[model samples]
Target: MSEMIDENAGGRVVVVGAGPTGLLLAGDLAEAGVPVTLVERRHAGRSNLSRALVVHATTLEAFDARGIADDLIAKGAPVQALRLFDTAVVDVSELPTPYPYLLVVPQYETEAVLQARLDRLGVVTRHETEVVGLRQDADGVALTVRDADGTREERAAYVVGTDGHDSSIRRLLGVEFPGHTVVASVMLVDAVLADPPSLRIATNTDGDKFAFVAPFKDGYHRIIAWDQSHPKAESEPVDLDEVRAVLHATLGTDFGMGEPRWSSRFHSDERQAEHYRAGRVFLAGDAAHTHSPAGGQGMNTGLLDAANLSWKLAAVLRGRAGDALLDTYESERYPVGTAVIKGSGRLLRAAQIKATPARKLRNLAMHFALQRPLVNRRIGFALSGLWVRYAAPAGAHELTGHRAGDVPLTGSPSRLFEALRGGGFVLLAPTELHEPAAEAGVRTAVPADGGPVRLIRPDGYIAWAADTPGAEEVALAIRASGA
Candidate 1:
């Protein structure tokens, strides 16, 4: 990483927060030979307090494009279906992607994979360097960073804030984080179980208490419990006794919860930043949106945000895309963020229904809805992020803006994703078609279908397609991608 540092510091981009989102974005930029500096406030170490635990299909596709998804799948537990209330389940086995289920790995493991990718690219992360404030004009962004050494200025062509919920960069940019608390004083505990539940997931409620238990990849369990009757502040201490009480009250047993390693009290909120971009600065991950942990979508959403933005940033920086390409990041991600917040909020509200009759009605309705394979499949698609697709422009091809499934490429016998090894677009065209500009960051491969031509973005979305694609279609897609 030291040797790979950019010679022209002023021309490089700086990413705040060395979390999963920042690391992935930095790796994407660096892999494309774009100068990037990743800054973090904490020393690098895997956290025992694993927050996000489920890696969905969309995220797996993103990782697979980087050639690390299979390795990550090897290191985690796979849950084929997510058990909702006793009557319903989100069967991910019906998903359209190769990864038809969720990988139950801790957040730390995700971070480690990304960190390794960054290291391989020689993109060193400057830890303990926190962005205190920032100011930007026509030229670049000047950050007020503080570390052990003291405060100093660091400049970059553009800055991205992937910092968590309470992001310093978001505040410095004067963005409004608008939303309300979904679950107050929710207790979280990571513990070993001498007598574990027969099921990998257990969720139930009794009277005013609610409890959920899901096993980690390591066989340990993470328990989340909340009690409407027992009001407490988020800072209040959480203990094994309190956990046992809540679990017994809600789930009829504690599953022999003992030997706690990490415990805390937190509140889930349904909120999103009013703006993801402000001039030259931008936000991704928790810095942009957050919501109830009911659907386990925060991390997945953030990672997708990074994947969408990184390519545009790289394209803009490399002079392959225009400045307008950056605008699409917010335009695309903001709606996805809004959808996540709404979906998670719905789940939280259903779980928090205090009245017994209301809970019964909700359960019955959900069960009836999930009774059909089509409905269940739709639910799986949404939770697993496979449901996400961009809006198609008028008079565009049918597949335009649709999520590009991994299709077998011509000649090489590899898939379209394999051609993305260099972090650029992959244009599939017949030998007769001509697209000279496609050579730069665009891999010209034979179409899997042996059909018409297609332009796939780095993040695996079809931008343009035609029966007889030429330089005009390729050029239009590149310009649309801001490449």
Candidate 2:
């Protein structure tokens, strides 16, 4: 095998799997002036089939930081609330953010947007390429890749696997993916429905069966249904008849479904890597974790994983941060992945209740709990990903490690997320502190009247904040964040 060495290999990143996670992460690195190479096993063509259909509010906010949220929002339908069973509803209209609803776009559409960004940034993706082997040393990583031409070895300072559940990189690293199957023989289909449900998202269960239906921008509906009484093997073929039967049984009508474009039968497993990082190699998206599709958190969680890791990788490679900054990627994201796994599993188990009395009780409890405003808002925030926060140190500010929402600012950028477009820390402080903040290697903005001084990370989280503006403290915080 021939060895291909990049002149800038010491500062380069090799990303495996050109899915949304890898695409977004590569784009972020390229935008930040870090060299990135994206590799994928699939041929270079956009496919219509997709398993993920929901984009949560927090993910949209992340896209907004990259200046691509508007483009993606234009390609999907937004649902203000999600209906679970006949009685419970989780409304997201009152969330304190620009995007207060869930965008129901196909996974392919999201991938297309990210791919466009990567193309604009001149980041070429190597398709029809697969990773056959991996090795890492103290200095960098070496990967064995196979393409149509031949097999070769490529080197990079770091390697990230955004590959799906059966990640070759994870296997090569011998990382343990521990979890069990949540449900078997789940049916997924994309079809044109003659009559669609009035609700933007329709989901319910009738004890033995459960189904979920959401609209696509192209007049098709993505349906996921399961029948506990008639479990089928993953190899069994799923046709329109079987899908129609389950939808009819669970949703009370198939909505005259016909002309299926895609269908499949698969099992849902709740698995997470024992560790996200192994020396110079890391895992993100489905490579790091996989969970039931109850709350549609799989892809959203993966995209967020890429967002969390991209900036850190860029910072370290660019010499703006030390290697320890890379460790935060796993510490900050592992707990979120674990919580999503458990949360989605709970939703799946709740929907799978098979007894009449138990189902009634489950629905009643959900309905009663959702009626309270506090509980309703909390559920909305959790599902939309706004409730996520990293662990903060004892003496840190209250806002530290929390997401910095799109608050108005008295400056040229005029918003917190807009300032993040430059891919650096942003300090929202008093006018008198602007020069000092700028000297600390961060963009400075004047906050609206009476707002506290804050240092926002490139990914839109509050790295540090203070009610009382102190130049020393501000500079120290920015330095501490490895800016």
Candidate 3:
């Protein structure tokens, strides 16, 4: 691993950011023997602010594919049931996966897990290195990086900007982040409440004000309160008194709130990048899109984006696939990003309803709808990301674009994700077809039911399915997957 930034390290792929998305990408690339370097502006030994707090089931399954899901689960607190609006609740204990509930852990804890995995993979992260500007060419892209010492230029075959919302690389690329700020001033703070409401989640609204309290693994709770009557700039300071007052005004009491830890103010926006790729450069995480924090979807979505792109980049660099393979990254993820932006924005709008009568009516409807077992199950599935499906090409197999969510592995105690640990597709067929390429990262498992052969992508999605598949069928699926 290259500890410090070296000049022109043989045209390695440069990942800009040390966040979870960038870490996953770099780790996956290096594990596949692709020379990659990660750059972050934060100083060494520095810790980032804890923002997002929920790691959804789909994301955990992605980590499971990479062989780090169990480690994260060991350190997180699971919430099987989530309370929303008023008396409505969503129980995800039976969400149909190895990880049935959303793991409630600070974003920093999630980052730490990725960091450790990167270290084990022998990936280096250069701190205090920021991407000032960049320009792409026919062959690759050139980045102008600034550090305390001076400025330098590094060329790479591809560059991915996984930086946060105020990404400098995204600005340099001149992509439009078109969206409006849904909330002007949102106050969020960490504190110890004498009377904690819920160990999982407590979210509700009173008139025009809303309050959400979620406990962390450290025995502290995060109080996110918003009052339309009190609009202030994000730069303004926040105080515990104000948090207490807002909680009291919105939730009828502060839950004996006191002993503030950290506080900040920020606004929520719903925006997505117009393009995920520009020449040899690509975007992921907050650089590609951003949305309101209503559903705790920000970090989870970014991690999934990294998972979707890492395999494609590794394939192209290793000469296993053609350049066109990279285009699928945008085509598949952009729609999901659009949906998250709209869905989370809609949730925020519902919570911020100004008219008291409208809010009451909406709450009544939600209460009735959530009471139905089918409706609750459906909501749980979607919110947990099990309902997310991709667009398949015309004439493709019926299950081509659907996820193979935790299928039982034949002749072992492991599941499908366990078979995908080393990275590549797993052929679940009824009989032994043929051995794939000696160098191909493919695994074969015969189902006990003697079902049709289904090609499962490294990201745990079905590429194609057929009653009988031979070497040619597997090769076609691999080519289509760019793996």
Each model's lDDT: 0.82, 0.87, 0.81
Residues 1-483, candidate 2: write the lDDT tens digits: 012223364889999999989999988888877888999998999966588899999999999998999999999999998778776888889998899998999899999999999989898999999999999899998899999999999889999999899999999999999999888888989889899988778899886788999998889999998887889888998867877888888778999898778888888899999999999999999999999998899999999999899889877876668999899999999999999999998888888787888888988898899888899998898899999998887988898999989978875788888888847778888878777677765788887755778888888888888899677777777778866
TM-score for candidate 3, residues paired by index: 0.94
In TM-score terms, which candidate is top?
2
What's the lDDT of the predicted structure labeled candidate 1?
Answer: 0.82
Instruction: Please give the clash total of every predicted structure, in order.
Output: 3, 0, 0
- List pairs with backbone clashes in candidate 2: none
Measured by C-alpha RMSD in angstroms, how accurate is candidate 1? 2.5
User: Candidate 1: TM-score?
Assistant: 0.94
C-alpha root-mean-square deviation, candidate 2: 3.2
List candidate 1 stretches off by more than 4 Å: 1-9, 434-441
* Deviating ranges (above 4 Å) for candidate 2: 1-9
Worst 10 residues of 2 by lDDT: 1-10
Question: Which consecutive 10 residues in model 3 have the weakest lDDT in total?
Answer: 1-10
What count of clashes does model 1 give?
3
| Cα lDDT, model 3, residue 212 | 88
Query: What is the C-alpha lDDT profile of model 3 across 1-483, one tens digit per residue?
Result: 112222354447899999989998888777666788899999876365777888999999999988898888887778888778777787788778888888888777888899999888888799999999798887788899999889988789899999989888889999898987877678888888788876468788875678888887777888888777877788998766777777887666798887767878888778899999888899999999998888888998898888888878877776667889889899999999998888887888888777878978888898899888888888777677788788888988788889888888668635788777867667886544636522355667766555667878778888787776677777677666655
lDDT of 2 at 326: 92
Any idea how many clashes model 2 has? Answer: 0
TM-score of 2: 0.96
